[model samples]
Target chain A: MRISVQLKDFDIGKELKLFNNGDTNIGAVVSFHGIVRNNSEKSLMHMDIEQYPGMTQKAISNYVEMAVERWSLYDALVIHRHGKLLLGDRIMMVATAARHRRDAFQSAEFLMDYLKSRAPFWKKEVTKDGYQWVKSVLDDESALERWR
Target chain B: MIKVLYFAWVRERIGVPYEIVETQSGTVMELVEELKQKEPRYEIAFSDLSAIKVAINQELCEFDTKLNGAIEIAFFPPMTGG
Candidate 1:
């Protein structure tokens, strides 16, 4: 029900509290948080994320709509950050609410899978050696085929 | 005139984020060929079309797709988001 593409960091606790408020019929809330990993070959300085402003939001919204319809979710929230991020920083989060745990869990994973490869955001890893654009992994693409 | 935009390394190679182009190409592939003839930078960036992805008016499409009055076209590599 909510999609946010922002530059500022988000408070996980606060976001969950807001999402869970006044929802009496919701039995399960599942959430996934993505963080910047520091374990690359070279020591990472930071990550530079670039996105196509208008297109990114539209792509994410379409994915969210698909998740809601497929899982019959009661509510869903997606918060993705753009710009620079340091190691250990939260990059994005997806939360799904449903009457049962199955729908909540599956929908969150589905959203994450689609967002990883389908969204317009591109990441450049700035390491001790230099900068390089992160390549799209075959595993990520294969993961999405299961939902089809 | 169509607005052509590039992202990530494509932008870095093209040396500009976007440009206005006037062309008579009828398909995406034709437009790319026209661009490749413009300069060496474009040729180098578009050398390996297999690694490139194209979008017509913000919607993903194949290279053979017709350019039917599309106002914008974008070129970038596969996305690595989230």
Candidate 2:
């Protein structure tokens, strides 16, 4: 299990290779990547991501632990980036490895669901008009409860 | 003294990133009430409890959680990251 909270973007291929390390016992691997999106109504210039330094990594570890405990995973990994980001930039990624695809896929989704609302990150979108904090969506909250 | 930290808009509105608070408040809500009495900015910043989330010693907890012997507490808006 690994949790990384960083400011720089990660290499997907390199991270996955390191996560699994070509373990022959692991037959299935699943990964999810999150990208910054543009505001449809406004021209988004950039986004500033604020996070609780010590707690951000702590929160992510808890979520990853939960996924690892509930699933038959060989490995679990999460990489989240903070600070300034532009549209289409990769913001985060999670990968899960298991003997079969089911556990890998479910746990990967479960990790993502938890992080969407539980992780200690706040995003402020800057546009031509102004800047505004991205509000937590009700759907995102409900998404977390799905695995429960 | 308890370390009180704020993040995001909470930090922006409160006008300070963090402060060492000396208080007799027993619970998180009581601590909030005490801060609210300090000035109008604290009250304005914490007007909506639903919009805020609290972490006691870096662990998420209810607003009614006890503050006894706690070293740190953080308050921020609901997280929007994934």
The numbered model that scores best in lDDT is 1
For candidate 2, the clash count comes to: 0
TM-score for candidate 1, please give it.
0.97
What lDDT tens digits, residue by residue, belong to model 2 across residues B1-82?
Answer: 9999999999999999999999999999999999999999999999999999999999999999999889999999999998
A1-148 per-residue lDDT for model 1 (tens digits): 9999999999999999999977888999999999999744758999999998888888999999999999988899999999999998999999999999999999999999999988888999998888999999999989999999
Model 2 scores what on Cα lDDT? 0.92
Q: List the residue pairs that clash in candidate 1.
A: none
Model 1 ranges with Cα > 4 A deviation: none
- Model 2, A1-148: lDDT tens per residue? 8888899989999998798887788999999999989897758999989999999889898888888888877899999999999999999999999899999999998888888889899999999888999999999998877787
DockQ of each: 0.89, 0.94
Per-residue lDDT tens digits for candidate 1, residues B1-82, read 8999999999999999999999999999999999999999999999999988998998889999999999999999999998
